[model samples]
Target: MKTSLILGTALALIASAGMAEQITVMSWGGTYSQSQVEAYQKPFTTETGITVVSVDSDNPAIPIKAQVEAGNVTVDVVDIEYADAIRLCDEGLLEEIDPAILPRAPDGTPATDDFLPQGLSDCAVGSIVFSTVYAYDRTRFPDSPPRTIADFFDTGKFPGKRGLKKAPKALLEMALMGDGVPADQVYDLLSTAEGVDRAFAKLDTIKKDVVWWETGAQAPQLLADGEVVLSTAYNGRIFNAAVSEGRPFDMVWDGQVYEYNLFAIPKGAPNKDAALEYIAFATGTQRLADQAKWISYGPARKSSAPLVGLYQDGKTEMAPNMPTNPDNMKNALASSYDFWVDHESELTERFNAWLSAS
Candidate 1:
C-alpha cells in the first residue's frame, strides 16, 4: 500500500509540471524587444509562472498574417503598428481582444477612458507611442548638422549617404514634408496624383545616396558604421544607442512621423488565454509607464504619463527625449492609419519600381 501511494504522488507531480503554460510573443527586435522583455515579459513570468518566449521579426504583422492564413500559427502575441493591427483585425487574422480585460488606472479610471484616443481597439491594445525621426551622427556633422526635413534630401549640403526605411509609408510623408509641404496637408495632398509625383521627385534627388534598411536595429548601426550620415530611424532605437550605448547621435524631430505600437493575438494562438492575460497585464497603466524607462517611446495610456521618469540609466530624463514631447511635436505629423490602409500596396509597388530604375 505504501509503495502504491508513493508512485501515485510522483505521477501527479510530473503531470502538474507538464501543464505549466508558455506563450510566444513576436516583436520588432533589438532594444525595442529588450524593453518589452524587461517591462512586460520578465515581470509577467515572475508573477504568473507562465513562460514567455520572445521572438524577433522585421515586422510582426507579416508573420501573423502568414501564420494565420497558413493554418499553422506559432506566435501567441504580436507587437504591431497601429495600421497593421487594424488591417490584420479586419482581415480576421487576429483574435478579438475585448478592452474590458485590461486593468483600470490606479485612480479608478476605466481602461477605455484612460487610454489615449485610438489606443484601445476591437482586437488590440496600445503599448507605446513611437516615432520615425531622422537622426545624424553628431560627430560627423558637428558644425553644420542637418536641421529640417529638406536637408535629408539635399545631398549637396549633407553630402553623404542617407539611410531610409525600405518601406514607403513614412518615407513618402517625409518626402512631401521635405519638399515644403506642411504636416497637416501631407495626407490630403498625398491623396492626389500630383502630390505623389512631387514626393517621388524629391526622393529621386537622393535615390543614389540612399541606403535602405528593413529592420529597426539596422538604422542605428548604419549611422554608427559611418555608412550613412543621417538615417531615419525609430526614435526609441536611436535613444537606446545614444543614451545607453553612448553613441554620438542626435535626433531631428522636425517632420517626425509618430504612431502607436499595439499588442495583438493572432487567430488560433495555442495559448490564447495566456496571451490575453499577458496583453492585459502588459497594457496596464504601470506596465506602460515601466516601458518608458527602457526606451524613449511615450506610453499609450494618459495615466502612464505621470509615472514616466528617468531612463534605466537612472539619470537621463525620459520625457524630454520622447517623441511626443511638446518641443518635438512642434513640427511632427501623426501617421494616418486610414491613408496607409488604403494606399500601402499601390505606393509600395511604385516605390519598388522607382528603386529598381536606373
Candidate 2:
C-alpha cells in the first residue's frame, strides 16, 4: 500500500507538469524576431516551464481574422504594427490587458509608463521602435551625403539616384516636410487639401530620380548595387547590409519617421494568461536592452537607455543609432497610428495614383 501511494503521487506530479499550458505567438519572421525569441522567449520557457510555440504570418491580420471568424482562436499573442493594433482593437479582436499581472519597471512603476506617450494604449503595447531613414552609399557620394528630407528633394545639391517606399505613410510626411512644412506641422498640413497637393507637388520634383522600393530588403540592395545612391530604408536592414556586405553605406536619422511594432493578446485566445506572461517577459527592460545590442532597432522602454553602456569596442558615434540613445529617441518622429488607421484606404489610393503618374 505504501509503494502504491508513492507511485500515485509521482504520477500526479507528472500529470500536472504535462498540463502546463503552451502559448502560440505570431510575428514576422526575420533576424529581429528570431533573436528576440532566442534571447527572451526561450529563457522564459525555461524559467516558467511554459511552452512557447512561435509562428510566422506574412500579414498578421489574415490568420487572426480567419481564426476569430471560425471561432477557433489559436494565436495567443501577436506582434503587429501599431496601425493593425488599433484596427484589431476596434474590431474587438484583441483581449484587454491586465497590467496587474505583468512586469513592472524596477522602480515599481507600471511598465506602460516607460514607453512614449503615443506608444501606450488600452489593448496593445509598444515592443520595438523602427526608423524609416535615408541611407547613402558612401562610395557613390564620396563628397556629399543626404542629411535631411530637404536634401533628399534637392537633386542638384546632393545629386544621386534615390529610392523611397511605395507606402504613403513615410513618403507623405517627407513630402510635407520637403515642401517647407516644419516637422511639427506635417500632420496638420496633410490634414488640409492645399497642403496635401503641395506635398505631392514637391514629390513631383524628384519623381524621375526616385525608384520606389516594395520591400525592406530591396532598399539596401539598391544602395549596395549602386542602383540608387540614396534610399529610404529601415535602419536595421540598412545596418546589416552595410556591416555584412562591407558596403560603404550609412544612415541619416534626421527627419526620420519612427513607427512602433506592438504586441497584443488576441481575443478568445486559448492561453491568454500565458500570452500576457510572455509579453511581460519579452518587454522587460533588461531583455529590451540586450535586444538593442543585437539589432539597431530602438527599445520602447525608456529605462533600457542607461543599460546600454558603451559598446564592446567603444564605438561611441555608433552608439547613438543603438536605439537606447536619448538623442536618437528624441529625433524620431513618432508615427500616428490612429491617423493611418483612419485614412489607410484613401491614402493607399492616393499613393497608387501618384506612383502611376510618376
Candidate 3:
C-alpha cells in the first residue's frame, strides 16, 4: 500500500509538470531580434510560468515545412520577413490571429485602429519596421549628406564610390525612382517591360561605382571603414555602428524603403494557446515600446510611440523609422510582397545571372 501511494504521488507530480505550457518561437538571427526576445519574451515566460523555446531561423519555412510533413510540428510562433509571411499565409501554413486576445492600445485607442492598414490583418501582426536607406561616412562628406536615392546613384555629383544592396527589389525601386518615376508609379513602372529595362539601364550607369552588399550587416562595416563614401544599408545596422564604434556615420531616410517583420502562428502548432499568449505579451504596448530603446526598429503599436520618448530624444534623426511619426510613415514605401512571391524564383534566377555577369 505504501509503495503504491508513493508511485501514485510521483505520477501525479509528473502529470502536473507535463501540463505546463511550452511555446516554440522562430525568428531571424540578429542583435535587434535577440534584444526583443530578451526584453519581451523572457518577461512573458517569467510571469506566466510558460517555457519558451526560442529558435534562430535563417530560413524558418524549411524547418516548419519539414516538421509538418513529418507529422511532428512543434513550432508555435514564427517571426518572419514581411515577404516570407505573405508567402506562408498564401500557402495556408499559418493560423488566423484573433485580435480580441491582444492587449489594449497604449493610448486608449482601439487596438485595430492603432495598427497601419496593412498591419491589421488576421494572418500575422507587424512587430518591427526597418528601413533600407543611405548611410554615409560623415568624415568623408563633412559638408552635406546624400539626401535622397538619386544622390546615392549620382557618383559624379556626390562623387566618390557608392554601394547598393545585391538584392533586386529595393535596387529596382531605387533605380526607377532615380529615373524620375514618381514613388506612386514605381511598382506600375516595374510591371512593364520597357520600365523594367529602363530601370536596369539606369543601374548599368553606376554598375562600376557600386560595391554590392551581400547582407544587411555588412553595410555598417563598409561604411565605418570608408570602403565607399555612401551605401544603402539597414537603419539598425547604421544606428548600432554609430553608437558602438562612434564612427562618423549618418543615415538619410529620404526615399527610404521600409519593410516590416511579422509575427505569425504556424499551422498545426503543438501549443496554440501558449503561442497566442506569447504573441499578446510580445506585441503588448509596453513591451513593444521597450524593444525600441534597445534596437533601431520601431514598434507596430501606435500607443508605444509616446513611451519611446527617451530613445527618440537621443536619436531624433532616426524618427523616420518610427511608425508613429506621420511624415516618416506617410512617405515610406511598403515593398510589395505579392509581386516578389509571385516572381521570386524567376527573379532570383535572373538576379543571380546578372550578379555573376557583373
The whole-model lDDT of each prediction reads 0.92, 0.76, 0.76
Best of the candidates, lDDT: 1
**Residue-wise C-alpha lDDT for candidate 2, range 231-267, written one tens digit per residue:** 8988878776766556888887767888888789888
lDDT of 1 at 285: 91
Give the clashing residue pairs of candidate 1, or none.
Answer: none
**Sliding window of 10 residues with minimal summed lDDT for model 3:** 309-318
Model 2 residue 176 lDDT? 76
Best by TM-score: 1
Error of 1 at 44 (Å): 1.0
Q: What is the C-alpha RMSD of each candidate to the true structure, in Å?
A: 2.7, 4.1, 3.2
Stretches > 4 Å off in candidate 3? 1-22, 59-62, 70-74, 106-108, 159-161, 312-324, 327-331
lDDT (Cα, tens digit) per residue for candidate 3, span 1-358: 9999999999998986675477778876676667667767779879998978788765677787677667787789888777767777777878889888787885577778886555656678877877777789878777766777777777787877778888887778778787777777888878777887887888888888878787667788787667788888888878777765577888776667778887888888878888888888888888877787666788787777667644533654435546345765544567887677666677667667767885
> How many pairs of residues collide in model 2?
0
Q: Which runs of model 1 end up more than 4 angstroms from their true locations? A: 1-20
**lDDT (0-100) at residue 220 of candidate 3?**
83
Candidate 1 C-alpha lDDT tens digits along 25-77: 99998889999999999999999999899999988898889999999999999
